[model samples]
Target chain A: MSVKYIPVQWNNNKWKYNAVMLASVFAYLWIFIFVTPDLMSNEGRINGAVHNARAFGSCAFLMLSVILCIGPLARLDNRFLPLLYNRRHFGVMTAFVAITHASYIINWYFAFSPSNKYEALLFSNTSYGQLSGFPFEVFGIFALFCLVILAATSHDFWLKFLTPRIWKRIHYLIYAAYISVVAHVGLGILQDQQNHTFTVIFILAAIVVATLHVMAALHEKKHGDPLAAESGDWVKVCETTDMQEGYAKIAQLTAKERVAIFLHEGKLSAISNACAHQNGPLGEGKIIRCLVTCPWHGFQYDVTNGSSPAPFTEKVPTYNLKVEGNTILVDRHANEPGTYVEPVPLNIQGAAA
Target chain B: MDQAQAIFFAFQIWCSIGALIALFFLTIGIDRIDEDAQGAYVFRLLLIPAILLIWPLVLWRWFILETERDAWPNRHRPPRHAHFWVAIALAVFIPVIILVSLSVRQTWPVDFEPQKLSLLEERKS
Candidate 1:
């Protein structure tokens, strides 16, 4: 929330989110250990620890699949926002499970190798040039490394230190990790196994992720704000009646990005539509007193001047805006961040609370 | 240390030095700056271990996509969809790798790996 770094302010929701995740993970392992082997005993003799390893691998992969799906699902509908809120928690849990998966396999299979398990995991298979027995373990290892980086840095402390753009770029490794995972499962297991169910699940998960992202992009394109009307030197955003008190109307400035036109306390103020934190769309947010609260995270900046309140310093670019007849005219040249302009009071008698 | 051990450590040294050089460019900023670099602080310090492990790919991000170069006509700029292509490649490439590995199972022996050989024996029988 501030320029200076702060630890995650873990609240009740975070605690509950952690507890539920812990329970679900244990339950999954429990079923994998005690129940799944029994169900599949007809296939062949099951090595208990190796079976457990495969179980953990599949579980982690499935959990990651769901985690990947949850993002686009939440974006497509707010009903899934609750799931999105604790996504880092989900990722960290997946990392833990994946570690168990890798550890078990290394201990079971690679331990007996002439060289150490860790070394053998990479070097034992010199089949870099061949396909059938190409060491698929490295794919899981790659995915694990990606997951480890993501899980370790999922804390808000890293977010503050790395900054949102870098944080997001690094976190985009999750999709790469997912791809590695899909490959890990396909090449490692599906190639050898007579059973095709998991292959179907894997393909479906890929399709679902790809489809959702495409659909969400299309949806944003369809439902996004209308183009602003252009005047001589100013862009006409909207009428005063188009805005409700404590809410914002958005407009794209010529040669620049979006702007948020806020009406609060019977006064109008305009600022850059992007929140300084994570570039969240400020126009979708509502004002509480002088501050416009970003919807993505609760980052706030003063609508009157595009500055955060005292102690927590952050600023967003501002625009000069005036009313021409009833239509709002916003200057094409946006003011530098934290620049102030007096809010022009509306003449309307009644304002929504 | 054996030959493989020496090779691995040698690889690590080369990668770390390369990663450090890339980190300098990333820290100082370059002409081909990625748009997302705007919010980023100095994170090369945290990325040391990652750089040590996968320096080649990490260096690519800096040298190409992370860096903002003048997009020359018919020349490749830093791809906006670097991660997307990697993801797509993973979905297809791994299966192909496995098929290739399967095809040449008999062509080469996994040297210095008797345990793997025994496992291979079981499959063969």
Candidate 2:
């Protein structure tokens, strides 16, 4: 929403999000180190820093899987949007946990290599031709670096600088990174590890992530655009009663876009269906007083003008409406964003008749 | 040095050169992404050594300009039902992977010398 370089904006939800994240991270690490060993002594293999490294890696992988699920989950239900607000924090956590794992690996197994640890990690593992012993470390390295880039640019400042489109494009590297991580785990650890627990968890996580994304996508398609309106300059919306009081009836535009025509206070005014923030559907939201309060995060705009009330700068385009007979005909041509358009009174249709 | 050693060192040289090119040439697009041009350049400069010294793999990855659209409208490719079938296909496909994986005998390269060496160490009071 902002183009200027402002410091990190904190809120109650963000504070709660960070605190919960920190608690869960510490709890996971504690349990992995202190409790997991006692329970799996029969099957447990590695110990000390090496074991710690794997534990951190596993935690990072789980974090990434959950992080990926949040996006599609939010799309599936507006109730999940609260989780979406502070999602970048989760991404940063994943990167830090992953780096911790990488650090431990460097410090432990490769500490006493014949060559320098890094050179040995790269040149010593030249069995790239073999599937079982291939250098899967390369994939992990790529994923880790991508995570670093994503974490670095997660700031709104960067979002403002890069433009949302480019920023989103750059962040699509997350999918690439996720794939690399999957390969890293699948081909590297699971191939030889005797521990079936990690294998089961990995498989389940993969299934859950893939399944959630598909379900979310399907949910969107099911509620897709209604049939296009008629071709004349003014398109006929539903009869006055179809749009309930304080509710909106979404109309499909010529393109794939939509407008939300809200019925409020015995009058009708239409606004761009997409919220100024993150393109959440405003049509699904309710009208409070005369403001259309977005269901996601409660960003509101005046239904009369499609402008944010006093103090807030955000705005949306409004459509012109003129009630003719029992039908409410709305101009397909949208007014400029934040421009005021006098709402059509309910009596106008009655008077015309 | 054996012929293998020479070739290995040569591969390392190529990796080093590739890394250098990726750093300095992070691209003009980097500026367009951020409003603060100086800040963007500085941040990219900080990334250069990491892009170089961390792994030679970043040499190529750092320069990748191709972008994938996974956001709304474009997020659904072939619709969600298509993505659903893909998920179902993967679900069906996984058990076969496990079955095949069970057959491959693993010869793990385990070096327990670190543990062995620590066994006789005197305990601190």
Candidate 3:
């Protein structure tokens, strides 16, 4: 009900970092385009330009995919949440570079056509005229359109105007954009009948990433049912104050909500045992940097917001905790907002909950 | 069919197949995943790249399979504010300029040797 993790000052540094990343990418593209010589013969130069644009496009797409992956990884593994914090920067920058590359291809294909009037437009439409009119280009154009939509909406103001849910739906266009770029590479480059190596590489890379996700998903399905994973209702195993130093204990709240409570640095923290993004149980993950990091996907929620340090993470609910006398007791009735559940402490010595 | 026609037909068919296969995998894969995993975070990561490779498939999946839970046409509401339009315009403008400049910079010069010019003319024709 209450928005727990909403901060007073949306981090200005985060926006600045995004701006710097985008500016740097633009600078790099500017240098590459201006400094490069046009010494290659007409066909040769055009081919070279397309090739360079594609290489840049591929890299941009890869960066965008990684940025998109960060939030899931953070929710899956809280240690990785930091990566999600800067994901928008990466997404916007990748969009910028991709736009540059898309424009280059459009120009290289259209600008220098010597055909007059109708003939030129007709020629451009022919298969041999514009990089063989590879359907990939059409898809590429469509994807670029999506990227434009996404990049435009990336700003916080637009996000607020659009509402997180609506803005989020539109942002999903990036997926369509990714597929378009892939088709652009696959058909325009791989299906070229002349170049197979790069196509194969792209296919392989895609296969691996897709496979990793599938395998992870399968693993979660097989072993990740929160309700089935534990015995009994999630019970408060210890009093809030009874948790000693360097300690971790499992609490089963309901069959669906299992948690691990940890006492570290004289503070008590609790978190969902299951990863928020992929359902990887936190109970099995390694704790690093005072956060429980999911082994699968690597999402990290702050032990305090169930909010990830990362910007785009899904929030996991944290429970209400109180210290009563020497005996540890947890009320199953009241759950509070913004309580970050810490991972189970590895050892029991010198700890307090 | 001639060689060019053959290539076009082949490329078209291949893309169509690729699009279909991508849709197939995405549907089955997405259906199998749970609520948390299917959330925007993982969906963006796993599906975005696949969509990049095969957009029609992704669009079909997004509109038909994914958004179907709500409804098709009304799944995405148009933005209400003038600022939303402004944002869209700015996005389009930035890319349009870059595209135009790149086109201008790469424009071919008219002056050239007559003999070699004929070769280009022949190629064009």
Candidate 4:
């Protein structure tokens, strides 16, 4: 199994990708530069701030879009991974532009116009400036700070310096950054009447991302150990003989709130109903080649050890099971690692009539 | 040239400076022909533009501007370091030029006018 790094890496295409991106951004920059009025007057400065902020927000969204697309794009075709591999650079660049956009706004409103009556009164003493004055700006600033950390630590040198687990945990801050950006867009840009179109678009983006997260959560609730949250470890509720030949019997045990121990091909397999990737119920997904494949991301877990076949794949804990003759009994408490156990053979006892 | 035209010319010169810097970095960073085989050609292609672009900026920084002490603080040998100073100067100068250029350009080349609902409306006499 190839151990592909999360966020991946690129070799030569990195240079090309950066070049194309920088060129496009500069080209747009030039186009805008030659058109917009100077920040000389009060109105011009405000407009400039708004323009820069919107551009930064849009750039951030593009970065998010690219990040979201990388996984699906890689799965669709391996060749696309090169683009996906260098996504960190894109993310960092996007954040830098965003920060620049945000800083200009701060400077325009607060620092630049300190002499003006409105500026001094609005920004100088009040918490409103800190809180609502730049509604999205604060979140945008936080997100950019996180992005800077993420980008700086993205190199192999940093990866070695910070262990993979610590790096992974730190990287999770991206989701936090996304949330902040969403908040920024919602509160900052949407409040103004001038940015109606962008406000609608940002809201729609928020809805979509939120919907994905909700769906993932619901999936976990349905299939994940009904018991693990309620109890400590996942419990085996039933045994092989009690279930049908092909299908596993669903039961709630002491630890695992709900479990399905399938007896297939004269083998006993215990699994939590939920999928790990998106919390899709394992019971709903088909068991193929002794592996339970998630309906969502198609993450496959080996029934024997409850670990994924691929590296960077995680596993769920499975409980101990026992067969007591015609009646199947399971020990929900004890568990042993790497002990290859088989499901008991079944005789159709009830459906004969 | 009059003040406006001179300014425009200066702007154009600045624009060229910005474009040159962008092109330089872009050429080095990007794979134009091929990254592996024609590595020497890439470097050679960069030389002419680098020299032409750097020479004037160097002169401006040293003789005309007299800001070399302030600008090139890291440089111990003032006159001799003109070439290196020019490259660094362009690098700093280019981004600001590009950003300012974005603000000055009032009209986007692409039509941003709200589109008509139907083709018939758009084609109306």
Candidate 5:
């Protein structure tokens, strides 16, 4: 987080992440373009542009599949959370690769056509009325258009300007893009291929993506139901002994609202589970030196007042908390963002005894 | 022109107008609308493609913010069940599409007479 928005809030981790990502992408492209063809027999060889187009196209599809899986994977396990960070960079790179694929196709196939290249791309196959020979290029174009929009608005400035809700809604277009890509591949190449290897892989990839989403949804549904408080207006989160130091116990106020009650410095503090930036799950974060750091992007907030440190103005709503015997109860109602609330002292030894 | 070509032509025209609007909006209107965008020139350039695509909405929001700054409502709720349903729908839709396409696929006609030769004779020949 920053007071003034620069191009990117680059850090050591972002640099390392980009470096590894670029290296992997370059390695994949090189191996696919050069190594695979040499290993294959002469009969399996394809034209240079066509081979490059396939390499980049397949890589883009794989990257997008991985990008879609990251969110659900993170939800299923904490270890996958690192992949969630620098995801926008992954998305932008995938868009670049996809554009390269499109470029190769345009230059190779449509360059000699009488019409403009882009115009030819659209009108080359007008069999939209038929199911067998439908213009799958249109689907590819639509997906690319969606991807470009997403990549362009990926900056945090758009997040702040569009408001997180609108930003999130716009990003959901990725799902549409994914579906379009599935159609593009299925209708375009799957129809022509005599060999079933790629067809099986494509289908399996789509199934895996869909299955992971469904499983994650089920997991969330199982844990997301609102817990009824033992008393009115205050929800019993957990005993003092149950909470580990610097970690949080998440209380679901409703299906939509959640409170993160953190145990820090022998005291308990409750704040909104949603981070101010991108609404990342603050409940999953760890607190260090009185500041709770969001697991997704490391946006930090003071556990006591739910405000970020000086110069970083991000804030989450604070909740009033009281200790009764060994139990910690949080007020269901939240204070306004950045409101100061006294942390409840935790008697961990007494609770254990 | 065909329907597809007509639609493509219309989209091209829309984007042409959108590019012009995007230039003005990024330079001047963005600052007036969003304070975070103030002096953030590099990020504005990144937003060109999105602004070119959704220029109508951007212009509307810019106009609205001129009257009431920061009036856009923000929601921080966890995502709804729509994503799950969409995923399920696509899962069902994709396999069905693949099956239908394969079933309806056209096969080339063969116009040769049947050979009466046995495997040994065919091999020898």
Candidate 6:
């Protein structure tokens, strides 16, 4: 949304989001480090690097769990869309916390090793052949690597450079990272600890993330299927009276491409449902002042041309539309991005008042 | 050397090279290729870790940009379906791994006891 790239396009919303997130992280760390040990009996008390590592490690795991949940939650409900806005910052912070956790472990456990600390971390455990001690550090290392890469590339510059498709492909490593983390905890900590707290928490978090995703997929499959073509080269989207003012009715074409048919000022315009930024659901966004605003990041496009107003160079494919009686039909073929299509004027008497 | 050590040694070398390439790329090569990167400093710093890991790809892209100046490949390709399968695999793998780990957990010989000899017995012997 910027003509020139700055470090972050900070807004009031971003500041509030980040402040809340940071405060929560600090509070969690404080509770885990200071409050938890006192709650335990004297014989069971934990402190030093062990306590610190657990504090940050568990915090990072929880943060990652929350991060994974945001996508599905946003898909399921619009109330969760605010969480999706500053997710990159959340991810980067999680990486830093994870790094701190790793640092505490390395400094404490591998401090006396003859070789390099990192080398010792990898080489000290050679029980890969055995299932019980399968060098769970490898899984931790893989997860850390993925997190680092993801955190590093979370910038918009990388998104533009790598292209959205490739960037998205790279970010899919988050799933692998999450799975690796689950294995790392399961094999390393759960195997050693008699306490089932972490085990239960990890199991529940994984299940919740997986279940939310499956639910979201099911929801999309049920509601997002393309509309069948009713006539030649056009698909009936809805009745003219059914179109909401300043809102879009999402129509899925035969090619599985979604078209957001917007109603504004007794006129209808159809554009690609995908937003140029992060592919946010443009159909879910509300139209204001003849411009449709993407709900996720607030990237806006002029409804008629499917192009962001000058100074911002984002665009989505536009589709031709027609009205027969009260039925709204959109052309099967989409025009090139930024191509302007004449808005089909509707009779005010026939449209919803 | 063992396989783990060997792999680590190779990785160390790769990272060492990547670090150098990342340094060069962030400082100079990025601006040369991408107009948007010309004056931006903070984003370049953020790119360090990823560039270090994928320096070869960066170099390849830089080389391509050096020749054509604007041939950004794969910018408009449709999203791939490979990640879906990977996700499905991970979903299945997570529970299976936890179960496998639990089932194969090693048991320690907790009943083993150490025998002690009395000082008097030792002296008599």
TM-scores of chain B alone in all candidate structures, in the order given: 0.37, 0.34, 0.30, 0.24, 0.70, 0.66
What candidate 2 gets wrong by more than 4 Å, as runs, is A3-5, A38-44, A110-128, A230-240, A251-256, A321-333, A346-353, B1-125
Clashes of each: 13, 4, 43, 24, 0, 0
Span of ten consecutive residues with least summed lDDT in model 6 chain A: A38-47
Query: TM-scores, in order shown?
Result: 0.72, 0.70, 0.46, 0.43, 0.87, 0.86
| Residue A186, candidate 5: C-alpha displacement in angstroms | 0.8
Give the best candidate by TM-score.
5
What lDDT score belongs to each candidate, Candidate 1 first?
0.69, 0.68, 0.49, 0.49, 0.80, 0.79
Better of 1 and 2 by DockQ: 2
Is model 6 an incorrect, acceptable, medium or high docking prediction?
A: acceptable
Best prediction by lDDT:
5
What CAPRI-style quality would you assign to candidate 1? incorrect
* B39-103: candidate 4 lDDT, tens digit per residue: 33333332333223333432333242233233211111112112233234333433343333333
Ranking by TM-score: 5, 6, 1, 2, 3, 4
State the lDDT of candidate 3 residue by residue for B41-122, as single tens digits.
3333333343444455334544544443533112112221222332343344333433332232322257854367788889
lDDT of 6 by residue, A1-353 (tens): 33667777898988998999999999988987787653222236455787788788888988999998998788778899888998999999999999999999999988886777777887788887888888898998999999998998888877766656667888998988998998898788767665566668878887787777767766666666456466778888888887777888886664336788888998899988877677667888888899999998889999999899888887878889899888889887778888999898887787666
Task: Report the C-alpha lDDT of model 4 over A38-87, residue by residue, as the tens digit.
Answer: 31122343565666655655656656745644543443444554565456
- Predicted candidate 3 versus true structure: per-residue lDDT over A287-323, tens digit per residue: 5556666554466666555666655445555654544
Ranking by lDDT: 5, 6, 1, 2, 3, 4
Lowest lDDT block of 10, candidate 1 chain A: A1-10
- lDDT at B88 for candidate 1? 55
Error of 5 at B6 (Å): 2.9
- Native contact fraction, candidates in order: 0.05, 0.05, 0.00, 0.00, 0.42, 0.38
Q: Identify the superior model by TM-score, candidate 1 or candidate 4.
A: 1
Residue A282 miss distance in model 4 (angstroms): 6.5
Chain A TM-score of each candidate structure, as shown: 0.85, 0.83, 0.54, 0.52, 0.90, 0.92
